[model samples]
Structure formats: structure tokens, C-alpha cells
Target: MLDIGIIGASGYTGGELMRLLLSHPQARVELATSRRLMGQKVSATHTHLKDMVDIQFENPDPHEIKDRCDVVFVAVPHGTAMNIVPKILDDKVKVIDLSADYRLKPAVFEDVYGIKHLDPRNVVYGMPELHPEIKHEGFIANPGCFPTGATLAAAPLAQASMIDSVVFDSKTGVSGAGIEPSQASHYPNMAENVQPYKLTKHRHLPEFTQELQRLDKNLTNISFTPHIIPSVRGILTTAHIFTKGTLTKYDVMDLYTEMYQDKPFVRMMDGIPSLSAVKGSNFCDIGFEVDPRNNRVVVISAIDNLVKGASGQAIQNMNIMCGLDETTGLWVPGIAP
Candidate 1:
């Protein structure tokens, strides 16, 4: 069994990592660290895991952490994980960063986040369906929530070099904001309302561009806009893909089917995907419709922002890195109504 350690375990993503790891047969959470909440119970902030996780938060030395855990998940925020990751990372312990720090190239990360990267090590972009090379890497940079859904929605077409340009519009739940309640996530302001932020230049846009561009170098015309919805746990992305040529519905479906046939977590649906169908699960349910008149293929993808979008995806990467099936501990259905 692999002993797991989660650094910065006082937030939404950290709580999620603890919750999911509880059911993993080959994994055990040995450490959950939080500087501010040191010595406090993990379930104090993550009440949902009250009875499930009995461990208290502790501030452990990074070097000591490396020796205690076989796998370490850096669940800290941007600019913060960089401080912790380099200390705990070693050949014997695999590191998976659930932050924006290692996802982009050093220059790009500095440009987007406006924070200098102290440690600029090469790591696999851990989107299992897209990067099979993840299985061979010891360090993984987990994809951002918005980029995860948005990139997957357009990957098949991008890979086939059929896309002329694409616009990604995403609606995300409040949990994506984090555990801290902000003015935008405030109940009065966010309730019965949809707020769109960072319209033209969201940070995650670069990730979407980077991943898709890897498949097709010419696939550069990508636009993304994200909105905050009233709900609390999922992200649904609508990709308006302007294809190079006319594509019949059957033709579009065939391409997607062929691309994701072996990918267990990506579920291609006959109808449009819904957040309710994929909520609380580590699955990206995708569907598409071709609008022949406009030569636009609208692809929709749904995923739990905290699961497939963050922690669960981290676990998925861990499984692949450890030579286990990608779906080993995450092959459950979403919580549906």
C-alpha cells in the first residue's frame, strides 16, 4: 500500500483528496498538513468527512514528509505550492502538484500568474486521456479545472486538425473558488445570478491553448470565457468549434468515439451531458451536435470541478504513475437526482 501525504489540506481540494483516498484499496492517507490549522481535525473544515477521516492536521517538515509518504499531493494554491513542492520532492517519493505552478512552462506560468517560479522542473501535464506519457513520469502537474473540461471538449477535433477556431464558454460552481467565501461567492451576490469574470484573458486560457496546441500545432485560435454559477460542485463547458469543413453528426461522433475509446474516465454520451449526471464523480461526460449551416460543432462536457477537475484527477494520475489502472479507485457513478 502507498502512504499518501497531502500538503495544504485545509481547503476544498485537500478535503476532496482525503475523501477519495479513503476508498482507495492500495492507498492510505498518512499525512494532511495545514500551517494555519495545525493540530486541528481535518474534518473541522471539511464537515462532510467528519466521521470518515479521523486524522488531525499537522505541520510536518517537508523533508520528513518525503520519508513518511510514498506519494505526496501538493494541494496548495498558486505561488504557494512552489515553496512546499521542492522541499518534499525526491526520487523515492512521487509528487503530484494540484496547483497552477507546474502546469505551464516556467515563462508562461510567470507571465500568467505574475509570480516568479522558484522551481522550474519539467513534469508531465497529468491529463490521462490526453497524455499517455504520464504513466512514465514521477512528477505530475495536474490540469486546472476549467482547462480540464474545456480541453477535453475540443481535443478530438483538434487532434484531427479539423478545427478552424474555437470558443469555450464554461459555467462553474462556487466550490471552484475555494473554501474562502469571497464577494463573488457571497450568497446574496451569487444566488439567482451568473457572474462572468476574466472575459478575454483568464489564466486557464493558456492551459487550454497549450494542451490543444500540442495535438495540432495550427490550433491556435482558441477563446475561453468562464462564469460562476449558483451551484456548488461542477463545471459544464460548451465548446463552439468552427470546423474546417462540414461535419455530419455521425462523422463527429465517430471521431470522438475513436479518440476516447480506451479512456475510461471520459464517457461519450448519445445526448447532451449534464452536471447532475457527472456531479461528485471523476468522470467527464461529453456530447456534441453539429450545426451544419454555420459549420459549428457544439461540444458539451460535464465534470465535478473538485473531482475530475482537481483532487480525483490527481488520484487518477497517481494510479497511472504507480502502474495501477487509471480508474482503480475512481470508477464510481456520479450522484444523480
Candidate 2:
């Protein structure tokens, strides 16, 4: 069994990772670290795992973590992972950093994040459907939740280089904002209300731009606007993708099917996909319609913000990196209402 260690074990992503890894057949959580909650039971923070996971949170040195784990997931904030990851990478421990740390070119990362990238290197962007070759890599930079859903929605059209402009309007759960409470995520403000923030600029925008460009280098005009919804666990994205030429419904469907046919997590739906269908599962449900009059294809994509968007995807990357079947711990269906 692979010994896995998590750098930050108290946040939503970390808790979700612990819950998923506990049941993994080939890997187990060997170390869960939280400086403030050091020595506290992991279940104390993640109440649902009370009896299932018996490990306590321990704040161990990054260098020491290298010896304890064969694979490590750096689940800390944006700038923090760069610091810890560099220390642990020297001992041959495979790593997947779930932050915006290494997902872009050094210059692009600094531009989008507005912070100098202290450590920049070529790491596979961990979106399994787009880059299945992650199966052989030792380190991966997990994609952000919004980018995960948005990219899958537009990837097929983008790959064909048929897109002239794409507008992604994504509605995300409050949990994506993390454990820290904010005025935006407050119960009163978020309940019965939909507020759009970062309308013109969001950090995840760069990831969408960078990844899509790989499929077609001459593409431009990618816009993103994100809103916080009342829900607690999903992201539903509507991608308005403009095509360079007219295409029938049959044509669009054929493209997506051919692109995602080999990918297990990306499901092509006959009708529109709903959040409930992918809430707890490691699947991205995609559906689309061709608008002949407007020359646009409206694509809808749904994923659980914490699962397929984060922890579940992280584990998926781990399984691939370790040469286990990609669905080793994540083939279960989502809970639907």
C-alpha cells in the first residue's frame, strides 16, 4: 500500500481527501497535518468521519513528511504549497499540489495570481480527462474547482479550434470559498440570494485560458464570471461557446463523444446535467445544444465542487500516478435527490 500524507488537513478539501483516502484500496493516509489543530483527532474537524478515520492531526516537518509518505498532497493555500512542496520533493515522494501554485507558466502564474511565483516548474495540470498521461508523472498540479468544470464543458469545441469566443458563467457552492467565513458566504446574504463576484476577473480564468490554448494556439476571447450560489457542494457551469462555422446537433455530439469516449469521469448526458446527479461522485456530467440561429453551442457541465472538482480529482490523479485503475476509490455514483 502507498503511504499518503496530507499537508493541510483541516480545510474542506483536506477533510474531503481524508474521507476518500480512508476507503482507498492501494493507498492510505499516513500523516494528516494541521499546525493549529496539531495532535487533534481528524474526526474532530470532519465530524462525519468520526469512527471511520482514527488518525489525529499532526504538524510534522515537511522534510520528515518525505520519509513517512510515498505520495503527498499539498492541500494548503496558494502561496503556502510552494514553500512546503519544495522541501518534500527531494526525497522521491510524488506530490500533487491542490493550489494555484504550479498550474501555469511562471510568467502567467505571476500575472494572474498577482504574486511572484517563488518556485516555478513544469508539472502536469491534473485534469485527467484532458491529460490522462498523468498516470506516469510524479508531481501534478490539481486544477481549480471552477476551471475543472468550465474546461470540461468547452474542451471539445476548443480542441477543434472552432471557438471564436467563450463566455463561462459558473455558479459555485459556498464551500469552494473555503472554511473561513466571509460576508459573501454568510447565512443571511447567501440564502435566497445569488451574488456575482469577480465578474471580469477571477484567478481561475488563467487556467481556462492556458489549458484551452493547448488544444488550439490561435484562440482568444475567453471570458469568465463566477457567482456564489446558496448550495453547499456543487458547481454548475453554462458555457456559451461561439463556433466559427455552423454545425448541427449531430456534429457537436459526435465531437464530444469522440473526445470523452475514453474518459471515465466525464459523462455525456442526453439531456441537461443537474448538480444533484454529480454531487458526491467523481464525474463531470456534460450536455449541450447547438443554436443554429445564433451560431453558438450552449454547454452545461456539473461537478461536485469538493469531489470531482478537488479531492476526488486529486485521488483520481494519485491512482493514475500509481498505475492503479483510475477508479480505484472513486467509481461510486453521486447521491441524487
Candidate 3:
């Protein structure tokens, strides 16, 4: 069994990784670290995993982790991962970082993050659907939540060179903001409200543009707008796409079906997908409608913000990296209301 270490295990992504890894059959949890919750029981921070994990939250020490784990999942914030990943790389421990630190090229990374990238050569952007070959390589930089959904929604069209400009309007849950409570995510402030933030400049913008461009160099323009809904989890991304050539709705659906036919996590639906359909699972349900009236197409996609957006995708990468079935330990059905 592959021994796994989770660095920065106090936040929602880290806790979710713990919950998922505990049940992973081919892997074992070796270490879980958190700076603030050091020495505290894992269950104390996330009560949902009370009986599942008896491990305590330890301090972030690369040496300690390198001694125990064959691979490490760095679930920390963006800039923080860059500081320690270089040292971990020296130990030859494979890493899957759920941060934007190394998602783009050094120039794009610096431009979007406004920070110089310390180690650009060692990391690969970790969007399994887009770059499945990267799994054979070592280090991975997991895509952002919004990029995960948006990219998946538009990838088929981009691959076919059928789309002109794509406009992504995504609605995400409060949990996407992270576990560190903020005023915008406060109960009263979020309840019964739909607020659109990060209108012009969101970090995920560069990621989406960069990834899509990899598929089609002519795919130049994208308008991505993200909103925070009152829900606790899940993301619903609606992409308003202008097709360059004539294509029927059925044709677009067939293209997606053919593209993701082998991908276990992607579910192509006949009707539009809702958040409830994908919550708590690794599945990304996609559906689309043809707007011949305006010669446009509306593509809808949904995924659990914490699952496909974070922990589940991370585990999927691990499965691929370890040469296990990608669907292993990810068979849970979506939780219904």
C-alpha cells in the first residue's frame, strides 16, 4: 500500500482529503499536518471523521513526512506550497498540490499570482481530464475549483474547434471560500443571497484560458464570472458558447459523449444538471442546449466543490500516479437532500 501524507490538514480541503484517503483501499494515511491544530486529534477538527481516523494533526515538516510517506498531498494555500515542495522533491516523494502555485507556466503563474515562481520545472497542472498523461509523471498542481468545472464544460468544444468565444458564469457554494471563516461567508450574509465577486480578476481566469488554449490556439477569448451562492457545497457552471461553425445540440452532446466515454467521473446528461445531482461525489455531470435563435450553445456542468473540485480529484490523480483503477475509492454516490 502507498503511504500518503496530507500537509495542511486543518482546512476544508485537507479534512476532505483525510475523509477520502481513509477509505482508499490501495493507499494508507501516514501523516496529517496542520500548523494551527497541531497535536489535536483529527476528529476534533472534523467531527464527521470521528471514528474513521485516530491520527493527530502534526506540524508541517517535510523531513518527517518524507520519512513516512511515499507521496504527499499538499492541501495548503497557493504561495505556501512553493516554500516546502522543493525540499520534498529532493526526497523523491511524489506530490499532488491542490494549489494554484504551479498550475500555469512560470510567466503566466507570476502574472496571475503576482509572485515569482520558485520551482517551475518540477510541477504539472493536475487536471486529469485534460492532461491524463501527466499522471505518469511525478508532481502535479491540481486545478482550481472554478477551472475544474469550467474547463470540463468547454473542453469538448474547444477540442473540436467548434467554439468561438466561451462565457462561463459559475455559481459556487460557501465552502469554496475555504474553512477559514470570512465575513462574506457568514451565515446571515450568505443565506438567501447570490453575490457575484471577483468580476474582472480572479486567479482561475488565467488557468482556464491557458488550459483551453492548449487545446486550440485560436481559442483566444473567454469571459468567466464566478458567483457565491448560499449553499454549502457543489458548483454549477453555465457556459454560454458561440460556435464558430454550424453545429446542432445533438452534435455537441455526441462530441462530449465520445470525448468522455472512457472517463468514469464525467456524466453526460440529457437534461441540465443540478448541484444536488453531483454533490458529495467525484462525478461531473454535463448537459447542453442549442440556441439556434442566436446561433449559440448553452452548456451546463455541475460538481461537488469539495469532491471533484478538490479531494476527489486529488485522489483520482493519486490513483493514476500509482497505476490503480481511477475509479477505486471514488464509488460513492451523490448525497441527495
- Which candidate tops lDDT? 1
lDDT score, candidate 1, position 220: 84
Each candidate: RMSD? 0.8, 0.9, 1.2
- Model 2, CA-based lDDT: 0.92
TM-score, every prediction:
0.99, 0.98, 0.97
How many residue pairs clash in each candidate at the backbone level? 0, 0, 0
Tens digits of per-residue lDDT for model 1, 237-299: 999999999999988988999999999999999899999999889999999989999999999
- In lDDT terms, how accurate is model 1? 0.93
Better of 1 and 3 by TM-score: 1
Candidate 3, residues 196-307: lDDT per residue as tens digits?
9999788889888988998998998899889999999999999999998778877887889888999999998889898998888999999899998777989999999999
| RMSD in angstroms between candidate 2 and the native structure over all alpha carbons | 0.9
lDDT of 2 by residue, 86-123 (tens): 88886379999999899988888888878888888888
**Candidate with more favorable, higher lDDT: 1 or 3:** 1
